[model samples]
Target: MDIQLLTRKIPIGISQCALGEPVRYNGGHKHSKVCTQLLGRCFDYVPLCPEVAIGLGVPRQPIRLVKSSPAADAEVRVIGVEDKNLDVTEPLMEYADSVVPALEQVRGYIFMQNSPSCGLRGVRRYLPNDHGIDSEGVGIFAQRLREHFPHLPMEEVGRLNNSEIRENFLTRVFAYDAWFRYVEDGQDAPRAGRVIEFYSAYKYLLLAHHQQKTRELGQLVSNARALEPREFAHQVRGGIMEILAHPASRKDRTNALMHVQGHLKDYLDKEETAELTRLIEEYRLGLKPVSAVLTLLRHYLPRSPHQFIHSQLLLAAEPAEMGFCDFH
Candidate 1:
């Protein structure tokens, strides 16, 4: 329930072009004001350009991943479309491999869409034998990043324009940022006490994901009085994966609402309770979760206000309740 954290800065990775650099194929940028304005207020951007890092100069020879053969599997060639000169695939691959490991500090990555080098998903991967391609592919660099940091919250700039997507990504980034410092810092063994302390702060967020697994994780932490670093890391990792198996959905919101409703039971009247229940029910059936919760809170809080019971306080609701969201 650290409301101050939402006001804290989040470290986010972004494509160089997205940061207003002229790194695109046509030497232009798709500068996003929303990213630079609203979200930027809370994010410290780390800009990267894989192609440029691999020694491609500004306005350099354009390269595209072309199919060498259909049967060659993923034998895509990064060749210059004009002169048919150099194949830069090997260098790009090597560069991506190097860069991914160096970016362990990043909790989230925001990539450009449809880029041959930086797209998070759905970049075309040409096959081996014939001039065929598969759209169900990710950029080589992005793939390497994901493989190295499997739990990092990754998104695209285009998608981040949506309020829900933006909020979700930001949430994950901050959560991961906190985990890195509190749980995985290597300062000491993540004892049951420390793990519980962190979990207590993130209970409600975890409930939206996997409540049962969250409890199991807490139990493991309690059971391990003298656990080694490796054992602690492994258990924590499993708990994180389970929490991130799915993002927040309407069902998750309804589950979360049930918890909050229980907390508000003594505060609201019968008529108010019915409206709140109906709102949560609607959210369970696919309406906006935030809207439903906000509507209820607005109508009731002024009459019987408890600052500690605000949605802001939900961030610290406990694992079973907080299971509603995940970062890494």
Candidate 2:
């Protein structure tokens, strides 16, 4: 596992305010140290302030999502809270549409929470009468972004405070970047053999997330002869993203770790095996983080030197980005 091979920085989309830019309506930044200090190290952020991008000034009037009707097709406007007559929905949506083309290259997105423009979920939406707020509405800009790139990994800086969600997002981002680079750098007609190898590398990782989904993805890859090169690649990407969307439970991860340990069992001595078992048990009991067990596994990775194990992203996935597990 050469660390240099995994050191490429993936391009990620982010709310400008989250990067500590003064783009908020109150003329202050929502400066997330997690995004700026930690993730910033592994990602090249493409920042966008929907409000500011739409020509809203600093210290600008706050906006809120307003539902015009109860119908599903009813128009929802991003209107000024102070002056209800000021409807900026068109401009906000327009800005979102305009920038989506550029966002195609972004592997992940980190949105500011509770923002009417950037919140990925749980954004407040008010009734036209201003009587109550609905917590189900997605931000206008975030909504468009999701519509454009549904498979791209997205999270609010707030939800990322949860270790599981944070880990999931980082894993998805790196996996997506690896897939993108492979396709972009490969030939016009990527061979089925190469796709099978890619799927093999991620097999254990996918198993940790969902065994059934992993099997199904393997079937898809195995049946690659039935589809064209581009189609097969798309299916593989979508399948990987879908599996990763589910959080990896402790039981699932322990199972995957045990499987990995089985591969190196012959190489490790009794004492080494006992020590590895202890660390795995610690992780199972929630006494230690996944990184602790992974650290030990990675130490033994070079000793055996199997191609399948060496190429496993599960072992080498974002070691530097794991520093985020310590922060909110």
Every candidate's lDDT: 0.67, 0.82
* Per-residue lDDT of candidate 2, residues 1-328 (tens digit): 2222445567899999988889889999988887888777778899999998888899899998888876777777888888988888788888999998899889999999888889888888878888555777788899988888878999998777676687789888877776766653444766666667778888888888998999899888988889988778778878988998888888888888998999899889999999999999999999998889898998998888678887776775544543323333
Off by over 4 Å in 2: 1-8, 71-74, 186-191, 266-278, 299-306, 321-328
lDDT of 1 by residue, 94-160 (tens): 8867876557777788889877677777766554333447765566677777777777888888988
Top-TM-score structure, candidate number: 2
Residue ranges of candidate 1 with Cα displaced over 4 Å: 1-8, 66-77, 83-85, 100-102, 128-130, 209-228, 234-245, 263-279, 285-328
True-vs-predicted CA distance for residue 290, candidate 2, Å: 3.3
